[model samples]
Target chain A: MKIGVIAYRGGNVRSICSALESLGVELLYTAEWEQLRGCAGLIFPGVGAALPAVQDLQRTCLWEKLPTWDRPFLGVCLGMQLLGKESEEGPAPGLGVFSYAVRPFREAPRVIHMGWNAVSPLMQDPLWYGIESPFYVYFVHGYRADVMDCTIAEAVYGERFSAAVRRENFWGVQFHPEKSGEVGFKVLQNFLSICKSYQP
Target chain B: MLAKRIIPCLDVHEGRVVKGIHFQGLREMGDPLSLGLRYEELGADELVYLDISASVEGRKTFLTAVERIASRLRIPFTVGGGVREVADIRALLEAGADKVSLNTAAILRPLLIEEGAALFGRQCIVLAIDVQKEAPALYRVYSHGGRIATDWEVVLWCKEGINRGAGEILLTAIGQDGTRSGFDVQLIRSITSWAKVPVIASGGAGALHHFLEVFREGGADAALAAGLFHEGVLTPYEVKLYLHQYQIPVRL
Candidate 1:
């Protein structure tokens, strides 16, 4: 099955493509809606601030189209933050695909909660398939999404925050699965399987 | 709680993993990709790939090797050496490097740090400072792979880099780089106390106690080593297990 990775400005498209390709999945790197329509699944990989990133999506007219897309969609890092109603990073409005707000960490020992940390599953879900609790994942971000009803996994640094949130066909993870070692690879594999079995 | 990081630094010259004593008398270890994979399997928290000859030879980083190795690993990989501009940083990130370390380039043009951090997030920009003691208890920053001394003081330069947009600092103690005596605990402690960003202590790791000392006494968020790991002196797994046994938080 083909997966279209949204070619948003300033995001690490190459690493995301490399990770997906390593899993034997074909990728379509494009911002054009027509090209994205041909893929069975979509991934919105991000790295930069919310203002310019959201502006880029709006410029390409992809922002308005995301909510209605009936496919398995995964958002990584900044992409996940953009799924929220808004972000404190830019105080910018996001896609509002999920009813939550992304806020910056206030009480962490370090502002950018980087390095390897453990994530616990909040409930039984396919994203946690074959994955044990307290698994290590790589996280690097100053902003975090609040724990909502859609949160499937949660992690605590200075305080509890949503690590992974799923709603219907949408999935958003705050960590970089591509860079989080063996267990991280398993997360990608699980996402691919979910996409393959997804019926639209 | 966040676990302390154990990083293995691989010095690569001409696509081969090499190690040197005080940045001289190079010896080949193995291929970069294989060594990196081995270290990851052996429980290295992170991997650093520095192109030792890139700046000296006035060439760009070996992106071909970096891309190949990065595609095969899941841990965060940092690539450094000969990174001079924002375009170079972009290219390295496109080649699958998770972070790009800036040393000489950042010293030459301090604005490069701001530009890089603006284009990509600050998380991907690592300011690598090579330092050596100039006088009694006075440390100075070195450029060109620790060959030339700069006017900037170590603490002042690190603070400036952070203020200008560097997310992390990879501080290398030139005096202790390959000596395997121990980390520059005084240097590390002072910097970690002042700098707002996370500090990865590099150079001078001999026994497992050095790792313990760096974390406990030195206050380093991570500890990096090369010579010992290259010469089969210590494995990443053994060091991490030792840290865990001593009640230090490390991913086992």
Candidate 2:
């Protein structure tokens, strides 16, 4: 599979790319968004605050290029938030792919929800194939991606919130597959498989 | 729900696991690789290894120990003590340590934290503070393994640490360390009150209830204990079960 991952500052996208390499997947760093000619899927991952990440994407022209790619796209954490209209973290508008806004935890417990979280999978699709129920995936974020109807799976942190979102040809997860253990590895592996066999 | 964390801290000296009181004595506890593997089976959420030895000569030694553990262990591990520059941080990463902690080196060079984060990413850098309460409501930062005093207050360094690219703050109250009395609740409340990153309250964790008090009452993100974990008085899996019974989130 030909996979393209967006490289944002402070992100371990490279690690995820490395892991993908183990699956015999071909990966490309599309930080500049100039070369997307033959990519099968795109993985968008970011660390740090929301506004600055969006600004960096805009500077690299990836902000404008990602949405219209007509290919499978995956966003991790801040990358998932950037798919929304606006995040409470800043002035930079989200990609507006998902009809939602990033909202801060009004009465949330910690600033960053580090460590692993219990993932309750949904049966809407088979993306979670071979993965066990009540799986644990690493999470680190303050603001969560609040979507209208795109949410597919949910994770409980203070309250049950959207953990993964799947739109037509677009999927975003609030956790880091690169840092998440074996289950995380599965998420990336499944995405590569989906991109390879995507009918659209 | 936000889960409470149980961390087993290993004090490394001359590239071996050692245990001591007030950061002295330094008797060999056990092999770090074995202890790390055992802690994982015990269901420890995380593991931390404090070099505890801050001498210039100690860095080379700890790297060998860290490299061995990182290759063998499957769980998350943090290595601290004597990490000075961005290159030092890189070396630790190359050695296979999951995270590199900064103490005296970070205080001496603040920008080194940002540089390390830029090089290795923020999630890999841990900023540790050794603090002692000299006056009421005032905890001063101590360098040289809690001996020398820096005018910077504990909270100040914590805020600075997160801003300068530290993902978590390993705050140990020297007054409460090794006492097995309990954590400094006020100190826990203060450090966790404003720190943006995850705060692992270390130094004094005598019982499971102590861990509970820190997280529930003190609002700490994680609780770490070296003596209790090493002595086998309190196991991480048992604590997780107890906390889960009380409606606290912990990995089970």
Candidate 3:
């Protein structure tokens, strides 16, 4: 199956692409919404701040097109933050795919939470698949998504926050599965399988 | 709580992984890709590839080796040695490396740390400090593969590096490197207390107990070793299991 990774100015396109390809999934890196028609799934990988990332998405017209994507869609890190209504990191409006707001960590021992941490699944879902509960995944961010009904997994650094969120066809993970080792790849593998089985 | 990390460091010279005693008398370990994959499969938390000769030869890191290893493994990998500018960091990240470490260049132009962190985020910039004990409890920073010593003290330099936007510090004690004794617990304890960021204690790791001491006594968030891991002296799996038994959180 083919997956389209939305390419932006500051996103980690190469690493995301390499990770997906290693799982035997064909990738199409594009910003044009029309180009995504041939793919069965979509991935939005990101790095950098929210304001500039939203500005780049708007510039490429992907911001307006993201919410309507019918296939299995995954957003990673800043990509996941962009799915919220807004972020404390910047003044830009997020895609609002989920009814949650992204905010910076408060009273955190450290501002930047960088490294491997565990996540506990809140419910059984195909996205988790073979991954064990409280599996270690790589995270590097300052802002976190507030817990909501759509939250699938939660992790605690200074406080409990959303680690992975799912809303129908759209999925978002605050961690970088591309760099989270074998456990991380299991999550990606699950997503790819979901795409392959997706009727649309 | 975040589990303590066990990282296997690969010192590469001319595209071959090498090991040395106290950074002298280098011996070839094996190919970077195979050794890296082996460590990853053995449950290593992360991997570090240091081009030991890059700075000495005045060239960039071996990108080909990085790309090959990065493509094969599905883990967080850091590449260091001869990283001198923002462009170099960008190039390494573009080649699929999760983080790029700065050493000699960061010391020469301190602002490069800020520039790199600003361009690629602080999480992508790692400040690697090679420190030598100048006197009792006094440590000095070394550069260019431990060939040149600087006036900057280890603790103060690490604090400055954190202030300049380094998200993590890779502290290697030159006196203990490859000696297989143990980590410089005093130096690590002092640096960890002052630095708010995570400290990765490198050098002088012989047994699994050494790893435990660095974490428990030295207050290190992570421990790294080259020779012991490369020579099969201790497997990452065995170390993690040992740490888990001691109630020191580690990913099994």
In terms of lDDT, model 1 sits at: 0.89
Interface RMSD of each: 1.3, 4.0, 1.5
Residue B237 lDDT (model 3): 89
Per-residue accuracy of model 3 over A107-144 as CA lDDT, tens digit each? 66667787778899998889999877879898889899
- In the range B1-252, model 1's lDDT, one tens digit per residue, is 688999999888887888776557788888889999999999998999988774443234377888888778778889998888998898888888889999999999999999999888888899999999877679999998899999999999998899889999999999997788999998999799877789999989999999999999999999998878877889988998999998988887
**Tens-digit lDDT string for candidate 2 (A1-200):** 67877777655444455567767887788675666647888888776667667777777777777888787888888888888888888656989888877886655665556777887766465568788787777787777865347888888776667788888998889987765556777888888878988888
- Residue A3 miss distance in model 2 (angstroms): 4.2
- In CAPRI terms, model 2 is classed as incorrect
RMSD of each: 1.9, 4.5, 1.8
Q: 2 or 3, which is superior by lDDT?
A: 3
Position B183, candidate 3: lDDT: 94
lDDT of 2 by residue, B1-252 (tens): 556778889988767789876665678877778888798778887789878666666768788777777655545678887777777777777676667889998899899899987666677788989999988989999998888999899888888888888888888899899899999989889977777678889988888788788889888888898889888898999888888888887777
Distance from true location, Cα of A200 in model 3, Å: 6.4
lDDT of 3 by residue, B134-173 (tens): 8997999999888899989998899889999998899999
Which candidate ranks first by DockQ, i.e. highest? 1
Q: How much is the lDDT of residue B105 in candidate 2? A: 88
Instruction: Supply candidate 2's per-residue lDDT for A38.
Output: 74
Model 3 ranges with Cα > 4 A deviation: B22-24, B54-61
